[model samples]
Target: MPRQTILGIESSANKVGVGIVTDDELIANTRATFHGAPGEGFRPTEVARHHQKILPELIEAALNQAGISESSDVTAIAYTRGPGMGAPLQAGAVAAQTLALSFGVPLVPVNHCVAHVEMGRSVTKSANPVVLYVSGGNTQILTYARNKYYILGETLDIAVGNCFDRLARVLKLPNEPSPGYSVEQEAKSGTKLFPLSYSVKGMDMSFSGILTQITAQGKKLMNGKDTRWSKADLCMSLQETVFAMLVETTERAISVANLNTVLIVGGVGCNKRLQEMMRIMCAERGAELGATDARYCIDNGAMVAHTAALMYQHGVHINPYSGADYTQRYRTDDVNVVWRNDVLT
Candidate 1:
């Protein structure tokens, strides 16, 4: 199999990532984020259009970075098929399918969330335990059980990143470039004294109220109250509150699921404080945690490639036909990559 090379493309959100893998070595992992959710909130259709506008360039760049002369070197083409924007999924599907058709290789449809799990394993070297996926569109606690991945808890309203961005807007922080990064930087410098409030559900969480509380606090300062809103402090507070909820919820889920190892994925996982919280909690319980290592954290193409490489070993390769479909609402359980290859074949 010539070491089996897998090329992965991820366009599930505001980021466009491309990754390549040869055997266990990660050849290339690249991403381009379209800083779109600062002020204008997220519009799925708009984001999809943005992806469609740049799919070709990203795919080629990744290939070039991997030093591949042609598609023939690619053993499989992997892409995030669903649980993302319809338009963007279509664009990526078209790209993957085109490459598959041209190169005569299998087109592996990967679950975006599961890609996190795979990347987490690559980063942390864990053999499956638990996953905390907190991103712009999703907040979920998942674990593989009964031959299927189960969602232990999730958000009732908005995602964690969405809440952060909303709060950043209220604070009128630097919305340009990376708002999350900006908020974190501001929080490091912030020394204010405004406290945010919120509670975590048994396995679920609510971030909207937290958002409102911080917004109200910021508005009070605008009313000429004698206050010092150190952007860093507020950022620290907000991060503390949200990260605590996630850590508490994750701990509970771990206790109930009887799993110690926890893999934290998504953009929020990029937060050092959140990673530290999870690490400390896991250490207290004698459970290993997978949160650090920039490779798996945040949305990127390498995670996608890493997943394809593993699923290929598990025999999840399925070549799409000429009329194969790209789904918009695909469930994790619906696509059983582990043992579905023979059945479908």
Candidate 2:
């Protein structure tokens, strides 16, 4: 078969990313993130504007890095198609549509969640693994079956990353690189693990209570009234408490599915502590663990491009003029896994 090249654009949230990929190589992967003020979270409108302002440059840079001089060099243009903020998702879709039209190529819409999973598989070379997808917007345990990713468990209220971000705000952590990163850094120095609420109903988890407790504790710490726990200790306790819940749920899913591989993806997957905890759990079960660094763990276009290339290869694509639109609440299980032929082990 001839080689195919795909250009992927991702603006599902605060980051705008562009990636170029061929059948055998990742030609380019570039991105820019919009950092909100300290203690302030990103709004959809502001994030969309940031993506719009930076997308063109990122696209050009990606293409240049791949040594492609014209849009025609790309076989297809793929963009994140949803389960994200409406405005940010639209920003990427518009760019993708324009690129497809300008290049006279097919336009592919990729599920943001599926992209993360595929990227994890690609990077880790895991054939068929149970997925632990934890990000700012999502937290789910999934396994592939019958041409779909089945959700074994998920967050009932707020996601794990959101929990960290909220606590980061309460602690007034910097949001420059990321709130989660800052929280992770602080957690490394934490020596005490306060008793926080652990709410796990069946396979679903709840983090709102934990966030609330930490927020109240954070206020007291900031006021120099809570000498029992420092900021680092709070961060540490949160990580320990939440990560334990995730590990417990993931282990259950792995056993239920009888899968030997566990792949962790998403922004929070970049946390070394989380990775360590997951690693220990997988090891205890005699299962292998797969994960990617921040570049692929966070929202990025390489995963999208790589996934799109797989979809395109499997005859999954739409005409550029089909008036393709993004869906804000697209679920991970909503996608048909047409590109994957593997079954659960």
What's the lDDT for all of these models?
0.77, 0.93
Choose the strongest candidate by TM-score.
2
Clashes in predicted model 2: 0
lDDT for 186 in candidate 2 is 94
- RMSD per model, one decimal: 3.8, 1.1
Those runs of model 2 whose alpha carbons end farther than 4 Å from true positions after fitting are 343-345
TM-score of 2: 0.98
Error of 2 at 59 (Å): 0.5
lDDT of 1 by residue, 1-345 (tens): 558998888887777788888887988877776655444455667777777777778878888888998767889888887677777777777778888888889977788887876687677777666889887777889877555667889888888888778767766666555567677777776555467776787899998888887767666655656357655667778888888899899999989888879988887778777888899999999999877545567777788777778788787767667433567667655656463222110
**Tens-digit per-residue lDDT, 218-303, candidate 2:** 98988888879998999999999999999999999998898899999999999999989999999988999998898899999999
Q: How high is each candidate's TM-score?
A: 0.88, 0.98
lDDT of 2: 0.93
Candidate 1 stretches with Cα past 4 Å from truth are: 175-177, 219-230, 333-345
